[model samples]
Target: MGSLSASYFERAQEVIPGGVNSPVRAFKSVGGSPLFIQSAKGAYLKDVDGKEYIDLIGSWGPMLFGQAHPSIENAVRDALSKGFSFGAPSYNEVLIAEKIVSMIPSIEKVRLVNSGTEATMAAIRLARAYTKRDKIIKFEGCYHGHGDSFLIAAGSGVATLGTPDSPGVTVSTAKDTLTAVYNDLSSLRNLFEANPTDISAVILEPVVGNMGLVIPEPGFIEGIQQLCKTYGSLLIFDEVMTGFRLSSSGYQGLTNIQPDLTTLGKIIGGGLPVGAYGGKAEIMNMIAPAGPVYQAGTLSGNPLATSAGLAMLNLISEHPEVYDALNQKGKALAEGIRQQLSELQIDGFVNQIGSMFTLFFTNKAVKNFSDAKTSDTAKFGIYFREMLNQGVYLPPSQFESWFLSAALDEAHIDHILKASRIALEKTLMA
Candidate 1:
């Protein structure tokens, strides 16, 4: 809405595709020009026009402590002082690796990458090499980055843009990536049965954020784990969105469902561009110099990323209460939103876990992507703009999850709820 942002976007459109690096950031689905942020600090994002909003997107689930936390900032500063890329090993990388391995039960050794896409891509390759199979299973609406294999039925920005499957993905790559319905055991079972021993791995967001915070139905994740075990398929938890945000370790930590492999990003980078995938030692050992399957990044485990991540992990490790606080904050916000919807007699559902949630403009329980599709996207669009006008910045799509950060206090939660009430009311009028 700001003139400066509009000017920047118009300029960017000449060079950057869609005037944004990522698709959803264009606010295509929400029907508005995206706000170009000037800066963010402690739960607030300041647009170039000097307008500030309570940031619920949280940089798409990485700003766990909100933007520019003192500790993380200091960590980055210190690391920056040591120079940038080493193109070689660094002590910070080792320290962060050890922290990750020690925290996440499934990760024996983690190889860092630059983004979630790289992490999931590498994980799949490792899975194929380890299992000696060509095909893998991925759930519908559970995005595992934009890897060619994952573009089929991908969620998040892909879903937001209404392209369930991207065009450039090769048919062969699509064939190797089997699709299943999320939270539906029968669908997964059918995939396994049909594929038989061909599925190298079954990867999913254990608590899907891409399809707007759709939680797994009871025993859904466990069923997938069992099927993977029965068929000798590696069960991979793509916790790019849920990692650390869900629990200290991830959704796996909360459920104790031991995945054969895990892909992590977002909070692990402490708001930096970083990702990691790790699993049973034997399986992970197959990556790079450790064994045969090759995956490398020049910026992998960069000093700055490692330093920030290490600081984040250390904070979480030392203060277990952060999770509790986050959960409480999520509950408060979710409950307030539900209450607002009920009071307005709006047909809406709030699916939440920990600090991640979605308010679907539907009456039905959203257990899968199909249910998620039932949301009134038009109404959601109106609500989104209204909320933005009210200074509450939410994820700019009906298909994305909003992240609550530790920086949000009681006052911030109250402000969000007040904004939600007005937004929901306005949405009904629309």
Candidate 2:
């Protein structure tokens, strides 16, 4: 959008494939080169060429307190003064773990990792070792990072690229991962029945974010819990996206379901790269010096990440209003967009839960990946570009959820609504 961004992208393309470290950031799906960000403060990001846009993606759901929050910055600074990773344990890691355990009832003992992928990979290994099984069941479109076992039918970048399954994934790896439909209890039931007695874990996004904010139907998550219990398989809620974004306790709090193991990332790090997995003490005990199942990372408990995480968790725990505020902002945005769409005579369905939502250009309810695919992607793509031009940032792909931040205010919502109104007008004309 700016001269600096344009020049940077042009130069980057010569070296970086698609000029982006992450595929979605290439803007292939949305059309246009990505905006090169310079810095962020509060609710806006200033691009390299000094163009400011109200950030709605919130760094893919990590900026819960908003970007560059002084407290978190101070925490990171203080931790840096102490030194970075020691390739060993740190007290801040324990403090962050205790904070997580204190906030989320399901996490009994957590093992810190560098990213959501590591957390998921470890959780699966622990599950496999705990159950002595070889297969895992995950819902289609519920992305649990790019782990080989999770790439069977992931959303996010894989969905953006129009590849449901990656090419390099071996049949052996694919065989170990079974897929089921989200929000469809019958599909999961069928999968369980078809493959009897070999599932190590049943993992899913309790509030599906990857396939554009597909909320679970009532009793859907509860049914999965029941099935896992019956099959003696661990029910692992991949809370990587929904963790602190949805509620203080995550989907478990909203759905009232306690998973055997929960994978967390995003907000836990306060915009840093960090992830964690924990569950019933009995199962977690099997993952280390206590048991044979081994999972290790050099930066497993990096002090910087943990310090930022501690600051974030401490603020969220003390102020439950953070969740309430985010819910209010999300509701406002969803309802405002709904009204605008109706006014524009656009056939759209907006699926939302707390701060995560998607505007599907279809009349059909998007409760699963199949339903989401039926949306008018071309139309949404146009709308996305229009919104971006109007200085309202959104997720570049039709299938990615818009991550709302607690930093959004009424004025920001009004601005976004105005932008949507204009964008919808342009989209309808096109």
Candidate 3:
């Protein structure tokens, strides 16, 4: 007899494309049927087949305090009685906006949207409008959501499936997006020189979470900032994954590199589907009612999302020490995994920053997408399945990052390390 999850997936395949809403959720890259989760609490997920695993994905970068955190849950519950969608302004929206503006270093004003895709799309549009240019530059492996332009040379599920460019994107859109090799300043400089005044902006993940938590080289970010200033192109940091999860403000707070515009999502919504883009008041003034460039959403700042987001942000503001604790946890986990890899004599590399981490099945140091592709994905598939069997859930794909939450206690970290050691042994044997 098939498990309940298998049965549901079978049924869903009849209606939903590939029996999953998102491409990564299909588990095509890992070569298996994806687990259907029943519920999540703190650091664990209860699968439909009545199995529980310590969660490391953290709902793909939200769930900072962990799944269904009481504060966010209570905020949602409180909002439920008030209302859902208003098709208009609400107090929570204003409060959350204020909180976001205050927290993020680059953002003086912010506009809410429905998802990270929306935020990036809007941000680029605003950049184009402000700069009066059409072309935009993006890193080869930085996934900035599923917008038409971003699919070219993208990362995450796209890289996992071996389809960097999608089918439906038009030639014009493809041409407008110039891809550069990540962590290489010369490549970006070449693009800027070739395009000159045609490029409107350069959008990227400051600390790229999309291509397995690749950290910026010492001078790479600074170089990008300088080039943007020199070329008169807007610098848009797509902080969708790194925002709040890495630090109280965002990656910008840690780096002190103030971008012209910033795109944010994930942790801000408190696991709700929400996104926002913000920047200098001069540029933001050009959006919608405030200026001319148009964008709107029926449920832009829905009461529930705003309430949950506000609650989460407030929690972060009140407790700045969470960042230190999270970094320690991340460091411990990364170190433990490295030790295991060395002891087992397995060829692997672990890239980590704050709460985001990824263990690549490779011998080379992964500095960019090119280096990341050297991973033995088949071996990673074996490790993933082994970890899953041992009650620890990691991101199914090697290209994606594993997100840690504050919910993971000392025991949880130890469990992860133990499971990883066993998994590494099994992976090596396999």
Candidate 4:
């Protein structure tokens, strides 16, 4: 007899490609059939087989307060009473827009979209329209959604599958998207020097969550900003994962390096499908009805998304101490994992900041895509399976970041650590 999740996946494979909507969800990197979740609440996920696991993914970085957070749930419920998508202007849309502007300092004017992909695509178009340049530069490990221009040298699922450049993206599109080595200013400078006037923007994840939580070296972000300025290119910070998770104003709030445009998703929608791009008023004015660059969505500001997002933003604003608590929790978890690795004599490296973390099965300090590639993925697969069996869920791929939610109490952390210890031992045996 097999698990219900396995049965469901078999059934789904006949209909859904790879038996999962997302590639990574298939657990290809971890080498197992993915768990079909029945429901989630707080820090726990109940799978279709009735096995509950302590969730570390947090819906891939949106569940800051955890799954089914009362505030966000109530907000969505209230929105349901009114209606779903309106296809026209609504009060909640305006409210959420105002809330975003107030929270993120760099965004002077914002336009809402359906997903991070739409936000980034529109942002790139806006940058091209404003700067009158055809090319853009992106860091190697930075995953900026599934836009055709971004598929080249992308991370996340693309990296996990070992396909940096996806099919269907034209040769011309790939050429226009210049790839730069993350944390290497000289590499970026060379690109700028080569491209010169052709580059329109430089988009990157200020604190990359894809390619497993790689941090920016000191002055690296500042150097990128300076290069963008020097080359007359707009700077775009893809904060789909980092927004609100790292801080109220995103990573820019922590670094004080303001970009010309910022793309945001995940937490802003409070687990709903929503995204936005905003920056200087002048550049934003060029979008659609405001100007020439065209971008529109019928469900751009879906009532439920706006309501939930507004509630989430309000909650964060009211409880600023959440950041401190989250940092402490993240530190504790990372430190605990480090201790386990030392005790077990496992060659591993844990990169953690705020509530985002990833324990690479390699001794190399992961600062960029190349370093991240050094990870022992086969060993990680063993560890992932062991952790799942121990009732602690993690990201299915080694190249993805694990998000910790505020819902996880100290007891949950202890459980996770205990499970991790057993998992590590099992991995060694395997």
Candidate 5:
């Protein structure tokens, strides 16, 4: 019988460009037809062809309690009965905003948007207006969405597709958006010194997941904050992937380094399409209806999205222990992968944080985007396909992080480790 996923891809290619809406979904780097998911429950995903695999992407880091959670589904259903969107303010929006403000120290106010891209695009404009400066600094491989300013030296799909710079972004936009090396304080300092007072803000992923779960060095984040303070540049933390996944306050809570602005998405929407940008009221007041900087959307605070987000955040807020449980699972998975590499005598590098990780096909310690590029993409492709064959679904690209949900249990971890052992052994042979 012909594969259902392959058949669907064939038809999709006739209609959808590249047979995928997102570049990473095309599996260009992984070298295989991507699996079309039918449904998900807890820690497992059932493909269109009836193949079941333990899901490790967690919908790209929003399914904290796993797919189709009862409470979240119920919330969405209730919201559906009322309406999907009002195009006006709703109570749930106020509640979610209040919750976020209470949790995140830097954000005294927030405005909801449709996606991370919108939040970041709005944030850069706000930063420019507040600081009255044109240039902004972003770390290499730290993707702040597909904003024209961020397309230069972007990561995630852009990095996976081997095009660090995108075409649509004009030379003027690229010039204003300065790129610096991740985890390298010297590179950032050089930009500040070279640009002088032209820079408006320095934005980064406090715990970078775009470049395959690259962790900041001991004082890297602190140094960036200091540099921003020194240069009068606002520090903005793009916490779309790490926000609620790391802790209630996101990376800011972990490091206690307050940023001038924060951009959030993913978990905040409970896997729905939503994003938000907020910081001190003084700066946020500069946004439209209140201030001169104008930003608006038809579905800015969609009723269904707010309801789902509130449900998810409420669960996380009530069960603080979920973070501990997630970290434990991460440690177990990291150790298991390390053991497999040791037993199989394979050269690999594992970068892991609480519930987010990447197993790079390289022996070098990946501290930055340059180091992450040293990974053997060809070997990773083999390993990814082999793992899929072993009923373990991972991110299609080596440049992406694998997210673990609270839905994953010890049994799932054991199964993933067993699959890894087999996949690694097969990978070496291939």
Candidate 6:
């Protein structure tokens, strides 16, 4: 019955709460039994029942070269042969750190952590320590991990479930995190004026991918940078999803904005778990043995993760064509989806940047979190299920970006286009 999803979910419920490690993986939003993946290769994932679907999520955007990339797999294999973890400084960690610093234009010195959440968490602490300020500003719908500070009006899981503010997050923590609307410059200026010397940093997902791939309205990012400069507040770019995926230097390259600190993950790990925050040496010096603000992870730069990351980064560094290829593919996908939407006479918007995109079924201009929230999510759900039934796997939520990989070629795109037409048709009928 329906592959092993029903049975697997039933069994997993007893062991893993909600039948999955991550809430979204349980497919609670998608309204179907979760397909327990057996394995993945290139742009395709094989479920336990051996059904292959073209993967659009890309493991939430980590598989830049696509699943089971040979170079990364071989590097991980070599690393595994060397023994897993020493808990001390590993050469691969240093190598990966150096590689990241080389690729990212702003990150002069770096620190490694295990997840994007950890990287963002550490970046916030470092900003506080460096500035000696207690308050920070975070935009609505820009998620910088599940850290308590970023819970207010956050995106991704929070947006998907309609839980903007978490119960456990204290008002004191929320107070320190001044809320500003993404792409709106006045809200930020007002927050700075009201807070004065108490503000430490203004952190954001420069492109705001968490809120359904909303690109910064032109000059919005630069405006934020100007305000940060005038106020002497740190500008932290939470590039977890955008870094390496957008370009070699990530979103900063696309926008020509130099942030004081950048939190990175996803693609840098090469499909493994890894996170890093690096910026100017002066601010980075505020962290660890070099300074006072403490942040440490025993598995931060796990050998295998670093090796895989290094291999991936090295490939990107040498062959920038990967970004171009993915960009062209992304443009094709966006254009195809938009054409379908127009023909169906559906009110929708396709927000995109490079290989990351979202087809928000909405009449509103999704410039910020509020605008993104206006999307017709129910219609999206119908489209999602239809696409899934047609052998195309997508992020189960309207609020998450669809990441494209280099592995997606002519056949895959053609399949997705064909399936998408049916999906859109189903949505209209519903």
TM-score, candidate 4, is 0.99
Model 5 TM-score, all chains together: 0.99
Where does candidate 3 stray beyond 4 Å?
A: none
Better of 3 and 4 by lDDT: 4
Q: Candidate 5, which ten residues in sequence have the lowest lDDT sum?
A: 247-256
Better of 3 and 6 by TM-score: 3
List the RMSD of every prediction in angstroms: 1.0, 1.2, 0.7, 0.7, 0.8, 1.0
lDDT of 5 at 263: 95
For all candidates in order, the CA lDDT equals 0.91, 0.88, 0.93, 0.93, 0.92, 0.89
**Displacement of the residue 189 alpha carbon in candidate 3, Å:** 0.5
lDDT of model 3 at residue 419? 92
Clashing residue pairs for model 1: none
Query: What TM-score, over all chains together, does every model reach?
Result: 0.99, 0.98, 0.99, 0.99, 0.99, 0.98
Separately for all candidates shown, the number of backbone clashes (residues 3 or more apart, or on different chains) is 0, 0, 0, 0, 0, 0
Better model by lDDT, 4 or 6? 4
Candidate 6 lDDT, 1-430, residue by residue in tens: 3558678999999999888887677767668778888999999999988889999989999999889999989999999999998889888888888888888889999998899999999999989888889899999999889999999889998888789988999988888888999889999999999988888999999877787898988889999999988888999999999999989999898777889999999888899899999999999988878988899888888888889899999889878988888888988989998999889899999987789989998987789888888888888889999999999999989889999998999899999999999999998788
Candidate 4: which stretches are off by over 4 Å? none
Number of clashing pairs, model 4?
0
Total backbone clashes of candidate 1, pairs 3 or more residues apart or in separate chains: 0
Q: 254-338, model 5: which lDDT tens digit per residue?
A: 8869999999999999989999999999999999989999999999889999999999999998988999899999999999999
Report the C-alpha lDDT of model 1 over 1-430, residue by residue, as the tens digit: 4399899999999999999999899988989798899999999999999999999989998898889999999999999998999999999889999999999988899999999999999999999999899999999998988889999988988888888899889998888988999988999899888989799999999999998998888889888988988999999999988888888889999986989999998888898999999889989888889899999889999999999999989988887888889989989988998888888899999988888889999989999999999999999999999999999999999999999988999999998888888888898777
Pick the lDDT winner.
4
> Which residue pairs collide in model 4, if any?
none
lDDT digits (tens) for residues 17-75 of candidate 4: 98989899999989979999999999999998889999999999999999999999999
